[model samples]
Structures are given as C-alpha cells and as structure tokens.
Target chain A: MANVTAVTREPSSEQELPHPYLLFLGDTVHPGFAKTAFGLKQWAPELCLGQFALPSAQIDLGLPNLRPAEARAKGARALVIGVANSGGFIAASWIPALVEALQDGLDIISGMHARLGDIAELRYTAERHGRQLIDIRTPPPRIPIATGLKRSGKRLLTVGTDCALGKKYAALSIARAFAERGVDADFRATGQTGIMIAGSGIPMDAVVSDFAAGAAELLSPDAAPDHWDVVEGQGSILHPAYAGVSLALLHGSQPDVFVVCHDPGRTHLLGDEQFALPPVEEIIDLTVRLGSRTNPAIRCGGIALNTSKLEAQEAEALCAAESRRLGLPVADPIRGGPAFDALIENCLAAPASS
Target chain B: MANVTAVTREPSSEQELPHPYLLFLGDTVHPGFAKTAFGLKQWAPELCLGQFALPSAQIDLGLPNLRPAEARAKGARALVIGVANSGGFIAASWIPALVEALQDGLDIISGMHARLGDIAELRYTAERHGRQLIDIRTPPPRIPIATGLKRSGKRLLTVGTDCALGKKYAALSIARAFAERGVDADFRATGQTGIMIAGSGIPMDAVVSDFAAGAAELLSPDAAPDHWDVVEGQGSILHPAYAGVSLALLHGSQPDVFVVCHDPGRTHLLGDEQFALPPVEEIIDLTVRLGSRTNPAIRCGGIALNTSKLEAQEAEALCAAESRRLGLPVADPIRGGPAFDALIENCLAAPASS
Candidate 1:
C-alpha cells in the first residue's frame, strides 16, 4: 500500500520562487512538441525548470535540455510528460527513463490517455517511493448527471469542425473580448491544457462516457442574468474517432448560442481522412439543430475561422468570403476583427433567460 | 458478506414446472402496476407465481393478491416488486413487508430506480440469509462506448414523442410484420418490459449515461444484407425528463430509417405537463433531423400512432387523418392496420447498404 499524504500548502507570495518542474519529452517529437513546451513556458513559466529530449529528437523550443540528475540538482520537484502523441500512449522505451525519474523522488504528471497509474511497474515504484503520479487527463470529481434545465442567463459554446483546430483559443478570445467590453462572461474549459490555464474545469474526454455531459453541465452552471458562459468544445460530431464525446458535450452544454470553429485550410477531418469537413454553414446548422433539441432557442451565433496557416491578406480574404457566403460573422478570433464584434453583439442580443 | 452462488439451471421440460415468482404490489395501483404485472405474465409465464397487492388497492386485472406467508406457502422462490412508481423508489411502508419476504429465504427482483441492494437493513438481512437481491434496472455487463461506426444491413428505430407511449410496441409490430413477409428481422429491446420479453437486452436507462449508446450499439450489431434490425426506442428527445437517454440512443443506433411513435390522445409531454406535444409533422422532422446527424441517410419512414385509448373507429379515423397530414403511413401497431405494411414496404425500398 502507498503512504498517501494530504498536504495543504499556503499560496506562495509573488516574492517567493515558484516550485520547479522538469519536462520529459520522449522520442517522436513533432509540432506537438513545440506546442506543449512553449505552451507551458507561456502559461506557467513560474513552474517550468527545464525540458529533456532524446538525443535523436528533431525539434527544440529554446528550453534547456538536461539529464535527470541535472534536473534534480536544479531542484525540479516534478517531471511533466511534455510530448503529445496520437492515442496518447506513452512509448515503451520512455518507461525506463520515467521510472528512473520516479525513483529519484520527483512527482510525475501526464496528460495521456494511457494513465500512469495503470502502468503497473511505474505505479508500484512511485507508490513505494511516496511520490505523486498525477494524470491530468482524468475527469474531475463529483460531476452530476445533467438535468437539462434552463440555466440562468445565456451560454455561448465554441464547437469545432475537428479537434485541435482552436476551439479553446476561440472561446478564450471571445471571453476576453466580452470582458474588455465590460460584459459578464466566463470561459469554461473542457480539456487538459485549458484546465491547466483556467485552474478549474473538467477534462471531458477523461470522464466516463455516461457522465460526460453532466461534467460539461457542471462546468457551465447558472450564471447571473445578462452573463455569458463561453464553453470550450471538444471533438466534432462528424469526427469518427470522437463523436460520442462531441455529442455528449453538445447536449450537455445546451448553449443558448454557439460559435463554429473551423480550420479552412485543412482538407480532411483530423485523424480520419475518409471524410472531408462539411461546409461551415452545414456544421453551424447541424450544431444549432442538435443544441435546439435540449433548448429550443439555441442558435449558431457566429463562426471562428482558424486561418493561422494562411498569409494575413489571404486569411482576411477567406474570412470575408465565408462571412458573405454563410451570412454569419467569420474571422480568426486571435487576429481580431468584425466577426468577434458581430458574435458578441449577436450573443448579447439573445434572450437572457433562453 | 453475502454467500454468492453461481447456478446454471437447466431449461424446464414440459412435465416439470419452472421456479415460481411472487410479485409484490404496494398500496396504490395504477396502469403501471398492471403493465408490469401483466407484462411479466404475458412474456415469462414460467416465472409467474402470482401477485401480492394490499386489500385496499383498486386497479386489479384479475391477478391474485396474496400475503407474504401465503406466497411462501405457494412455493414462490422469488418476490418481484411489481408496482411501478415515479422515480421507482419503493414506498417506506412496504420495506418491512419486503424485508420479511427476503428473510423468509426468497430472492428479491425489482425493476425500480431505487435498487434493493442499496437499502441498508434489507441488504444486511439478505446478506445474512444468503438471499439474492436483483435490480433489473441495473445495466447488463460488458457495455462498450459507442464508436459511431456504420454496422452492416439496415436499421429502423422507433422514436417517440414521450415515454410509455408505445415506442417498443411499434418497433415490435414492424418487426413482426417483416417476419410475416419472410424477411430476416430482429427486435432489439432497450427498456425493462422489452428486456423481459427478449430474455436478453440492455436496460438503457439503468446504464451509466456515457455507455447508454454503447449498450444500444451492442444490442443491434451488424446484420446481413437483407436483414433488418428493429431497435426499440426509449425516452423521447422532446421529453424533458429523459432526453439525454433519447439522444444517446439516437446517436448510438445510427438507424437507416426511423418510425415516429406518438400518443395522439395525450395533450402534454409525459412527466412534464408544461410542454405540449409538437405537431406530428414537427416530431417526425425533429427525429429525422436529430438522427441524421449520426447517419445522414436516416429518414422518417413511417409513423406509429398510439390510439389505445380511442374506440376502434376513432383510432382508425385518427390514423387515416395522420397518414394524410404527415404524408406517411400511420396506424396503431397493436391494431391490425396498413401502417405496418407501409412501414415494411418503405424500409425494404431503402438503399440496402445505408
């Protein structure tokens, strides 16, 4: 049996240094490598100690590459698995290095689908050493089943044509814009990275299938009148790999209004290439219709286009074309434009009690 | 701790009688009481020992009411809680009587939302006496999460405007009609009475919210080219109390064609009286549209009218009027009619691979 500790540390003051963390990047580095590493650096730089990559790794994001011994010498208290892979499985070759780090008394944190606790040897070693093994992908506790009641005020959910196509970023941008406009809006996260940033919100995909919607419902609870709950969307309903999660979230949020997030440059749905992305208009219509099943007043308020791959001029031209064709506001939320303005206006104009 | 036994009883021969069951009916009796009692009698006669109801109870369909001691004397090996109540909670007043029956060495079977195993005193007594406590509403073992893959052959799902409005009866009727035509068809149940009739089918509502769809998918696996999987529907997507279960089933079944079941005599949604039923046309449109999200080819092939409360002539007139109004086949499945014939024809004409 493991000796479990229930320690409650006082919040550290700004003058005190942050707890140091080491990042473990196994083999098979890709764009995800930079995203995870740079994302941590940008969002939680106070906790980052350094990053460690295999000698054969391809990409680097300007973080110091250190050995386990060097990371320990530098006072790293935890090792965060920094590489993202398809299916979120930790490679077998990385197990030895991870075991070594756990044995050295550093707590481990991961956002992988294959949980660390399920790794028998690694879990046993971590337990024996009295070190923490945190799996960020696990669902939050005490999520109740959805009652499908009309929550107070209104909610705007950002749904995507596919995963990793900027749903969270769009939601955050919209919430920030609303905040700037002196509107009472809150951003609700539903994934690991967003949870890391928000410090609260459920890891939706990690939840058991039955209670996924319940988790989403809890995250976007009744807000004060005239307030907006901007909920982050997970997988796409058209996504063959994760439609169940997507449908659960869609039904769970029961948004008063929704924004369709799309990556126009991509020719195929992520992970499944057999089907192409449906037209933005079709997606918006489908989402609104599905959301309306729970809340009859649900509507697709706007569209958030992911045009990061295109040149600024090209992206602007595409957004304008999409706006004209779909008869809805369309723009990259990060780039900021009339789309966000129209989106906010449309959401604010919706019946508050809907 | 309970002394659990794993017994495999042989099928009873004609000369030998099956294990007898006594149904426990608490004070109040309603249509639900008769449905449960008569449903068990009609479906599984081998388990029908008799029903026990209070002397003051009113609605009796000619079933014998026996005391616990009398039932025990009649060779009842199990006592089934036969009365259906809102939220399925057992009445507190009935607990003592049920405990007495359990302590008398009779196994307990129930289809209530309140599981007997959760009752502290009754559970302790049952455990001490080595009596089995079975909650039929509990989900069956080994249900998987839905993957949204297209199974082989064709599927026809019965969607209702509300619960207890005969979604299962409609599906069963269509399946029976198809069978008479020499077509390979199977009825897949998703609720308690249907499960009891089929001898093996998942209780969709009892399942954890996440795996509800998975349970449906498992019940209706891939079929041959000419085969039809007639999947029984549960709660209505429009029903306030059970829409989550409805949505899960719709997405999970991925039916090629659907039949909309509605109680024309009912003026309001079941459980929630505030919302009036939408027009039959609207219901068909909504069901077809929601189902099409998972399977684009999904269409509302026909309509199943629940005209049980109406006179024969009135029911026929209503079905005819509805058939003309909705531009689809409509008839009470229980009443011999053209609705089932039209449904079978429409289903047979659907593209085989969809």
Candidate 2:
C-alpha cells in the first residue's frame, strides 16, 4: 500500500497534539504489542518491541464498540480498533477509531478482539528509556515523520511480517528509546494490511494494498487529511501478496525516512535449505538492492531487528554489530520489550535524503 | 473445479505415431490429473499462488470451451477434462463417439479452466505400447472406471482437489499411470468446491461425493464400487483450521489411499547465514501424526514432494531419502510431469485392505 500523505510533521514542541487523542485500541493491549513487534521484526531489525508492565493504577481504557469519532470525543486516549465487517469484537470498536485517528491527529492504533479478556483494564506502562506512562489520560499525538525530517528530527518506520506480530510494541519500544534520549517521535499503524510505516515524520499517509478490497474504506483519499492511494505488486516480495501492497504504497506516496522492520527468520529462499539469513553484508547489499529496485533514488535508513526471542543485551549487541556492518546506527533499544517505540525513534533519526 | 467425464480411446494399430489429441477438452474432459497434482503442490508450499505449465501438444485437441458431456466425447485416447457452465467446442459432435470412447475404455482425467493452459500433455504417440486410434462412434454416457472393480460395471464415488497443485492433478496422474500400467481408473473433478470420487470397479452405477449439499443424487447406501478420496491440508495441521478439516474428512469418508502432496520448503526454519529445510524425518513423523490425529486406524501412505526449482533427479533423491528414512517407499514416480496421474496411480497401487 502507498503512504497516504507527504506533509511535514516536524517535532515542534509547540505544535498542537490531537485533542482527545484517538488511539486505535484493541483487546489484549500488551500481547498485541508483543505480536506487533514480532511481525515488525521481519521488516525493521534495529527497532525493538518493548513490553512495559502496566502500572497498577491505570484503569481499563476501553471505548468498547464506539465509533472512531465517538470514542475520541468520549475521553478515550486509546480506541480499540478493528476491521469494518470482520464479524469480530475489536472490529466494532476499532474501525471508527482509525477514521477519527486520521481525521483529528488521534493517537489511534489497531487492536484485536481475541485477547480483550486478558488485560481489559489498561493502566500506566513503562518504556525502556524511562518514558513511563503516568496515565494514558493524555497521550500525545505522535509527530509525523515528514515534519520531524524537515527539522532534522529522527524518523523511523516499523513494518510487521504479516498479520500478527507486535508491530505496535516494536514501534513503542523504538519511539520511547529516542524520546528518553530527547528525540521526538511518533508510533502508529498505517493500516491493518502489510508494511505499515510509522514515525516517518513525513505526513504522507496512503496505503497501497493488494487486499484493498478487504480494507478499501480505510484507504480512501478523503478518509484522512493525508494523501492516500492504493497500488499493487509483481511477485511475492516479503510474504505472499506483500510486495504488491508495499510497492503500491512506496510508489503511490513517497514518505521520507522509510525504516523497514524486518525478521530474517521469515525470509524464505526459494525453499532451498542453503538460503537462510544472508550474511550481514548480503543483507545490506540486499537492502540497497531492494531500495534501488523499488526506486532508484530511494534512500533507506537503518535496519530494525525484532528481538522477540533475544534478551536485552543480546538484542542490543546484535543491533550494534549490524549497524557497524552496514555503516548505519542500528539502534535496537528495547530487548524483550516492544520494538515499535524503538522504530519511531529510529525514523526520527533518519537522514531525509537517504 | 469438478472433473468432467473423459473419452478413453486406444489408438488403432494402423494409426501413425504422435497422435494429435486434445490437450484439454474444454470444461468436459476429466481434470483428474490436473486437479490432484495442482492441489498437492498448493498444499505443499504455503505460497498462495499456484503455477502450472500447459501440457505439450502439437495442436489443440479441439476441446476448448466445450460443455461437460460434449467435451468428454472428443475422440482422443487420453483426454484432460473439466466442468464449465458454458461448454465450448462440442456443440455439433455426435453422441455415439463419446459413448464408444467411454464404453471401450477412455483414459480420462479432471481439471479446471484457470490452469487449463498449464497442464502439459505428454501423449504416448508410439504404437509400441500397443495403442490404436479407432473411428467407432457411440453415444455419450457416464462410463465406469473399469470392469472388474464393479460387480455390475459401475461406480459409486470419486474424489478430487482444488485448483492449482491440488488433488485433481494428483488423482488424474495416478489414474492415467495406473491405466497405462493395466489398472482400470476413472477420474472426475469435484466442481469448484469439494472432492469428487467415482466408484466404478466394485459395484453401483453412479459416482458419489462427500458433498452434503447435492450428493444425494449419487450417494446411496447400497451403492458399492471402488472408492478414492482426495484431501488437501486445509491449514497447517498445527493450525486449528487444518485440524478441523482433517477430522471432518477422515470421519466422513474412510478413504482407501490418503495421497498427500506437499512442498518441503516453507516449513523449514530460518537462521543466520544459511537456510534450513524441514527434515524428511519430520515429514514422516508429521504425516503419521496427522493420520493418527485424524483417525486411529487410517493407514497413512507415502508422502509426495512437490519441487518447484529442483530438477527431477534432485526431487527423486529427496523423496527417496525421505521414504527410506520413513521406512516406506515414498512414490516419486510423478517426477514433475503432472499431479493427477501420480495420484491416480497411488490410489490404484494402494494394497487392498485385509
């Protein structure tokens, strides 16, 4: 899918945040974070998914089955999001959240209905770099990547492997790391399909999707203030039907600082046992090749490793080594935490041209 | 996606070699070979799209776009057939030719329109196989699979798979191979939905399918005949969907030979610097496990490997190694030709129950 809008969302401390922020919430918040992170690892490696234990003080912030605008207006910092006709619980609450999130700078993200019962009452949570959630009562609207890049703000993008993996988790982890380090960033899920680029300061908002038939309403150009378009792909790129949607997104709307969340584990080599994660050098080469192939002048930022299985030290070391190998700052800040935050911070740091 | 009746005509001794036959007789010729092969392959690699090569033939068999019965009557020794609401070529042909082909023994297979262009027909043009082309025309009728299997020379049930690397190709390939090797086999497609099995050898006159919606026309308690069924892995056996489908099929239809075609590429784990292929031992274990998981006493036969890039030799070696490791002769004779022929042969070769 294509990036929707290409406006600048520089991390100006004075810029107005979304009033009554629209957080596309789902059931099983942290687990959703975990799953999102796992999925994002396949796209961005240096980014991390941080799992901050919810503080005992937070209440169950659920706009159960509320419209996006309704949820936003009713003092919901997070709106549990779902698909339009998905015959599921989260679908009822989250579908509208997405619309409102886009319309009013709502800090909305997609959520699932399956695990709603687990942590129904969400409370205060913590990120690795000490950006603890005192209360989600006033979650700030994340600065769009375009704006950050205009002011040379670090920008990052976190992409999930497929449907389920902790994309939000990884984005949060990456975002919080940079935030604590005094970098401005935002974390968001572009949509529910594939290769969702968040924290790319660029306000280019569009989703070029192959499965647009399933999520067409969300991709309307008029849905959000950002530019939105749908596109297709050639062959199986990352996963089956992934390349088409990503190609559409990249070509349809050019977002500055594309931080791809990647998991080497998901990459299959024509079913050959001899083909696993190509060497780090090969990965860099492949990344450049992929970027070039996608667009000759396309500039790619650092890789974000999904440290789903790795501990903090191991993941950090792995990211650092990869960064050195690729001559890029591989910041996998959160080991065993949500990688989404780390992803946001990474996007904030990306050089605009590259 | 259901199999159409096929016209089985032996080449006359006086006929010249390299006989021109309809590679695909539109939607009427049995798609037996195409369906099973394609279905098996589809079930193999988790890759969504299926690729098939059209059968090799000097000229079209004049069976494109023919309706179900009309296409079956085409005077080809071995015809690839399928089902289409609007049949194409046979609007003017005599019914007698079709009946004669079916009665005298027509080598038929089933398939669908989507992959019709892919199944490469390898016609045995040489008379050395004691083949002949006859001009004896007859009326169109639903011919039985073979003589001895039926006490009254009729069939009760038939099974097939979905489009592209599924059970249709597997079933037809086996059927063709068996017939070539002196075993009587009748093939049928199960429409766009379920498996279609034709019971011809043992007893009964009509074909039977497990399809509950409209199977009463053929299914009868007294109907007795040689039976075969095709089942594709719906979901990963580990996946809940697969478990459910497997259980339902096994319990409902106690199939004779459970032919499974799968790709060994997708199941392997991904690691750094090198790729991994799931061990053949694991496949054996999984197949046996799946069989036991589905039903207690169901005899799980051999596993067929569907290779995309691997050459025939490599594929055979892989299958042989797996078979040896599993302590069973994994039938690898299909060798990249087609799926139906291999499947049909597999069914015919399955040892009779004690």
Candidate 3:
C-alpha cells in the first residue's frame, strides 16, 4: 500500500549505472551464487573500484576490500549488489551496510528480485541522500508472446550443463572475438549479471512464464543480415528449477549456432542436488531439438569449458581431449588463447556439417 | 499509485465468488480460445445461469443468452469471464459492458493477466457499485524454488499435446471420478478457469520464472497416504513459448502418473501455428523422461481425447483404434459413458506398464 513511486529508469538506464562500482558480495561464500560480482570483476574491471563484504563472508574477489565511505572517497559511483541466492532476496542483515552506502554518497544498484526501492529504510535513505536505486532486472512494459517467427541475421547462443558455468563469459568472449575479426556482432545478455556488464539485457528470471521467450526475441531483434547476436543464456535445460528459463531463452534466441559452457567440476546442479548436471552432449542435443522449432538451421559451435579448478596444462589437456572426443573446439573463454580463437572461428565460419 | 486498494479478498475469497454466474464472452469468435466458457458449461452446468456476450461475439455456450442486467435480475451474482485471448488481455471495446455488469449488481470475476482493477474506469465503476472485481490469475505471496523432493502420496497430472486441449477438464473429471469411486482425491487447479472452478489454485503462468515450479509444488503438497492430487496441467512441453511453464509444472507436481490430453482436431499449437503437436506416444515418453527427474516412478496413466468434432460412433472408433495403438485407455471425458469410465479405471487401477 506504500506509494508506488518505485524508480523507473529511462530507456538508456543501462548508461545510468555510473562507474567505477564497488561490488557488494554480502556474506555469500559460494562462488556460483556470487556470479554477478565475479562477472563484473572479470568483464568490467576498469569500471570497478573495490570490494565490500560482511564480516561473516568467506569469499573474496581478490580486489581491495573497502567500506562504503572508503569506496565513495575513492570515486566509486554505486555499490552494486553482486551475489544472487536461491531467491535473489535482499537480506535484512545487509540493510545497515546498504543504508551506509547511501549515507556515504553512493547509489545502490541491484539485480535482486526484491526491489531495493521497496525497502523503506533504503528508499528513505536514498531519497534523503538524493542517491539512485537502479534495478536492471525490470522487463519492458509490453512483451508479446513468442511469435515463433525467425528474424533476419545470425545468432550464436552460449548454453550450459548447469546454472552458472560461464555462459555469459563465453558470449562476451565470442562477441568480442567476432568484433576483433571485423565481424559485426553484439553480446545479448539474458540474465542479471550479463545485463550489468553489457549495460542492458532482459532479466530472464524476473519475466513471467508466458512472456519469457518473447522478451528474449525483443532483446535480440532482426538486425542486419550479416550481424550476429551472441546471446548469453540462462538456467540449464537440465536444471530442476530454472530449466524453463533456459529453454525459453533458447527458443526465443533461436541461435544459428550455440556453444556449450560447462564447469567440469560440478557433479550436481548448483542449488538442487537431486538432479545431476547432464553431459555437454545432452545439452547440445536438447538445445538443438527445442531450438529447431524456431530455427531449423540451429547447430552447435563448440564447448567453452570452465577449467577454473584445473592447472593450466591440465585444463589444456582436458580441452584437447574433449575436442578430440566431441569433434568440436573446446577452450576456456577466460583463458583466451589460440584454442578460444579456433572455437570462435568454427562458430562464425561456414556452419559445421554436424 | 491509485491507492493500491483495488481489492484483496481474504484467503476465503474463493468461497466469496458468488455463483449462479453469467458467463461473459467478449467479442471472441474462436471456440478454441474460449475454453474457459466451454469448460464451465461442460463441467459445472448447474452453477452457470446464462450467457452474456458482446455484439461481435461469434461463439456461444448454448445457454440462454442474456445481458448482465437480465442475468442479475434472474439472480445471477457474478459475470465470469470465460474467454482467454492470446495474452489474456481485456479488450477496451468490452469495458462498457463490464461497467454495465458492475452497475447491474454483478461482481466481475476474471482470470485475465491484465487486472480488471488496473483499468481506471472498471475500478471506479466497481468501487461506485460496491461490486468486487475478482482477479483469479494471482500467484500466492511467497513461493520457494522447487526442492525437487518427491512428496508422499500420489499425483496424477493431466498434460496435453497442446494448450486448452481438455487438460483441465480431464483433471476435473479424474478427480470427480475418483471421488465417485470412493477414492480419496482432490482436483488441483493450475490455471485461471480451473482455479475458478476448483475454488483455489496457483496461476502458474503469472509466477516469476524462478518460482514457477516452486508454486506448483506448493499447490499440491503432500497428501494422505493413498490420496490422489489430480493436478490440472498447462501448456505443452513441446510448445514453443509456454514449454518452460509446462516443464516447470511437470517437475514441480512430480506426478506419480499423468494423462495425455489432446484434441484430435488440433494439428498445430494454439495461437502459434508454426509447431505441430507431438503424438500422444511422444507426450507420454517426454513426460516420463523429463518428469522422472523429480519422480522416477512416474508413468503414463491414459489419455483423455477431445472428440467434439467427430460423430459419436467415429469418436468411439478413433478412441478404440488409438487405445490399441498406444496401449493405453483413451476416451472423451465430456462424452461420459462406459469408455470414459474405463479410461478412468485404467488410470486409477495399477499404473499401466508401458
């Protein structure tokens, strides 16, 4: 019943997010859940100032840990909430720190399902300090149901075997690689973290079920015939809870080619342990089968293996082994090298026979 | 914010929906899109007093047509929307008639995605007349992510080859038949019309993608040792747009057994004609394959065929032939007879071995 004066940023609100940002990890220990922070630090490091964590936090971003005032003094523009728990809820314990950020002359930006403006103390603090509360997770006002009609231009989507396995990173890398190769391309973000880094995206998780795929379509509309939309995917098609989001993204994006992103270390899904992560082969098959309903030309590009847990040489050996077994280029997008270039080359070149 | 006071009926609001209703068909010509009206007419004829339609309405429920005033005068308490368009949006052209209904002392109960109270004129009219503007397509306040834990007791979900293909009707029929046979059972609604009929349900489509499955889990929780929760399903797992919703519901309900609902006439998906409906065999296979993640013991029960377009003898012949082909009982629930009873019997008996 409170005044529905919640913020509605302008069309270019992605540009409204000022930088350098102070990443807020809260007290989350799991790296998978803190993907937003890790992604920003990885993709937009120049725009980031430092990190902040609650005392009970066990994870760190390797950046300097500073308080709100210190970060504000260091010319940080906003405190970006980076961790996403099961529900994307804003914890009550973090409110004091959030309010401090506002009082310390920094705006608060969040991709959380629970709106920051909806919290009374934060809203009051923001209003008093003239600080902004930007929620990039908000979808557009009107999104039609999926037309199931293919649009012009090519698209390459990054899918995964589980929830947070570097789909966004692969997308960002492929888009950048394409740009470097003098091919016109764009990184289309489907989730919150990708949206933050790319400056705009449809928060697939926040969308209603009916309009989920439609939102994806609108995000990457018909572009020039040669242009490519390197779309970042969401939840896995095999995940117990978020598979719907992933499938909706797949159908909507209708990628001409897709890359399988996987964390080889994860046996079970990120949060739900009942379900095991399907093999990269299963993900490719399902993505193609379901995605073909929208685009018949859909095919796999390669695999972006997240070899974070492996030694450099060991990761290379695994990538080599996977490439040999699957007959597709496999490489870690983060460890960009000749292998990643080969993977990108296979994706953008003439479509593979398979 | 317009006071944010449009309406909020208590938890007992389902009981507050005054019956002996006037079904409102607003300018809709397609019979397939008007499944809600047809469903109520077929399943709950006694509570349906009469029909009301706009000048442009081409579809009819075969009940005596009456204006809101006439129906109200004849003791109809509410005007229930019985049509679902592409997006469940209320047409602006029908606003005048809706206002007239409110003026005539009839509450307006709609399962529309666009809320009646959100329309200024409708809200003002309802407030002025002290008539409740009930929106049934509302998810509960809190829904957790699907735990993927198989609950106790049993569940029989009615999935379909496509949407609006007698899934809700099939579920309602199964539940009622179970009760008739002295089996402990309950009808769990998933969509608006089903909820309106069942008195309570979670509108799966309205929920956020993250909590979509979780909402389904909450809807049909653990029941008595031998009780059956016959959940009304939504959208097809093969549907281009709504497959995510269907898959989420499938995983969430984790049905011990499921019936494949289909309209023999519909070749393609509703609204989106690009997709061809998968065969009943495919539906059963996919339902069991994907649904096995949550409930490994899941299996196909039977099939509920909608044979409204065929001759009585032709319908029976098709059901018989298809039953032989698929090795499962098949019958039109609306065409209740020995065949229908046999279909229910097969479903409730030992879960049929595939």
Interface RMSD of each: 4.2, 20.7, 1.0
Residue B276, model 1, lDDT? 76
Mind giving the per-residue lDDT tens digits that candidate 3 earns over A112-160?
A: 8789988999989888888888887777667888887889999998988
What is the Cα-based lDDT of residue B54 in candidate 2? 33
Looking at model 1 chain B, report the run of 10 residues with the lowest lDDT sum.
Answer: B8-17
lDDT of 3 at A348: 83
Best by DockQ: 3
Task: Rank all candidate structures by their DockQ, best first, as comma-separated numbers.
Answer: 3, 1, 2
**lDDT scores of the candidates, listed in order:** 0.72, 0.33, 0.84
Residues B206-311 of candidate 3 have per-residue lDDT tens digits of: 8888888888888888778799999999988877788889988998898988999999898888876677878888788878887887888898888899999999
Model 3 alpha-carbon drift over 4 Å, by segment: A1-38, A49-108, A120-132, B1-38, B46-108, B119-132, B352-354
What value does DockQ give for candidate 3? 0.67
DockQ-better candidate, 1 vs 3: 3
Question: Per-residue lDDT of B204-236 in model 1, one digit per residue for the tens?
Answer: 765655466677777777779778888899777
lDDT of 1 by residue, A1-354 (tens): 452221211111221112476877787557565465556666567677788777767876567887767888889877777777877888888888888887886777777778887888787887788877776666656566656667787788888887789998888888888889999887777776665445456776656544666766777777787888888888776554455567678777888888899999888776556567767777777777667766788877778989989998999899888889988778888888776687677766755563
